[model samples]
Target: MKLSQLKILDAIVSSQSLKQAAEKCHKTQPALTMAMQKLEQDIGFTLIDRSGYRLKLTPAGERFYKQAKRVLSGCDELDKISSTLALGYEPSICIAYEQLAGDQRISQLFGNVIQQFPRTQFKIVGGSRFQAVEKLAKGEVDIGIGPWFDIFHASGDFQSVLLKPIDVILVASPKILANGRTTLTSDELDDIPCLTLKPTELPFDDEKLSFAKGSQVVMVEELATLRSLLLQGVGWGLAAKHVCKTELENGDLVQIRLSDDEDQFQSELRAFRSNRNFYGPVASAIWQGLQELY
Candidate 1:
């Protein structure tokens, strides 16, 4: 009938005797009995079995308590949300990160930020090339972290901080370069398929990412899929160094040096948020934490 009565019933159901329940609830046994008696009278049914040595819930009591427990759990959550709101924290935040940025690093960043604001919910999503920026533009996410592109800078709608540069090296499976060639020319790769991230938007220049002028291009929606295809010798393409560090070291995938000056690629990653709307404390904390961690 009341939250206090339900709480007393919960304690009684959990304990071995009325005396124990009274001790747990910080009340006298008589007061505890009186409370339950009032509650049962209001509910129009007996809620406890008193014939046994240890008190137990009646069949009806068991059903009623099941729902009561959910109410208590929700109350606890509401209390936490109210406290968090009082401190001006966002209840939830969503972040979109480019796959090339490395998952382990992002996980570490999340771990650090979570320790600071444990009640704030976080939704992390891995995206393909330029996908993070696209999500930011569409207001689909609270924050975006990925390689800095001219388009992002030109937009002027985002506030950004530059992080460390990520190295992107051209690589291929050893089987694809079994000829023992230490370096390759664009013409040499002309016949191979280039596995690349599919463009998320139109009017984007694919030429800037092309390694071979005549190579057949395979558009992949995810980096994991592209890496798997590269491992199978399906194609040669650019990959982030950290993403393929183990494979490159084990000789499963070999870096193909281009004859031209562009064999190795490096791009700075940026953490940015939309300038259109004001962000809450949690979003601001995460954005600052990212800049510090990176």
Candidate 2:
């Protein structure tokens, strides 16, 4: 019934033995046993199955513990929120980014933010293509860092700071190249399976500067999967140069060229946020820091 009793139960379930649980809870085995006994008496049911060598939760206890865990998690979040509010910062600020965002830069920015505001919780969500921008538009995230397109800027509801420009190039395994030719005609390109990011809220148009616009596309949600497929000669697709830098250098993957530079395009990576949301201290610090760091 008491939160302390629930804590004891949690420790017992997590630890290898009752003695280990006692150490984890910072209480003697007898004390922990007495607490659980009192808890069972209050609820009029046995919570632990003691007949077995290893302790196991009874059917009723399993159900009760599931609900109790939720309460404990809620309490933890409530404490974090209270502490964050007391420090005059947002409870949490989430950064949604695509694979194109350089890992080194993102890590450096994240580390700086942690050092500046240790009390604020930071969440990082990874998406592909325009999914980060879509999350920003829906207000699901406090910030988005990914490829920038004029269509995204045309909305005028978001503000962005440009980061590095990424070169998205069409690549495939060398095994698939017949006669060692890197260039593929439009008809030939369409004949090959093209790994691409799944469509987001943004409209799809062949007229837009997209690599897989006119290909036999195989949509994937993650960049790693797409890269794996390309490595296995499963398909050809466009990917950021950095994402496959090692592959290209090692000759595991070869860039497939198209006429009129349609095989590659420069995508500007930008950190953007909605203007509608009021910026808290933590969010403002992150926004400003990204601009300075990138």
Cα lDDT listed for each candidate: 0.80, 0.81
- Please state every model's RMSD to the true fold in angstroms: 15.3, 10.2
Q: Candidate 1: deviation at residue 191, Å?
A: 1.4
Q: Best lDDT goes to which candidate?
A: 2
What would the per-residue lDDT of candidate 2 be over residues 1-294, giving only the tens digit for each residue?
A: 899999999899877489999999889999999999999999999999998888989999999988987687667556655765686887678899787786686688788888888777788899877888888865578889888877896543899998888887889999988887888787787788888777776544222434555667677778878888999998898778888899999999999997644677787889999775667778787788788875
Off by over 4 Å in 1: 1-87, 103-105, 202-209
The total number of steric clashes, by the backbone 3 Å criterion, in model 2 comes to: 0
Give the lDDT of residue 70 in candidate 1: 67
Candidate with top TM-score is: 2
For every model shown, what is its TM-score relative to the native structure? Answer: 0.66, 0.67
What is candidate 1's CA lDDT for residue 59?
94
Q: How many residue pairs clash in each candidate?
A: 0, 0
Candidate 1 lDDT tens digits, 1-294: 788998898889877589989999999999999999999999899899999888888999889888987677557546645755686787777899887766566678788887888878888988978788887765568888888866675544788888777788989998988586859777877778888887775245455556556888988888889999999999898888877999999998998887865788777788888765556778777777787775
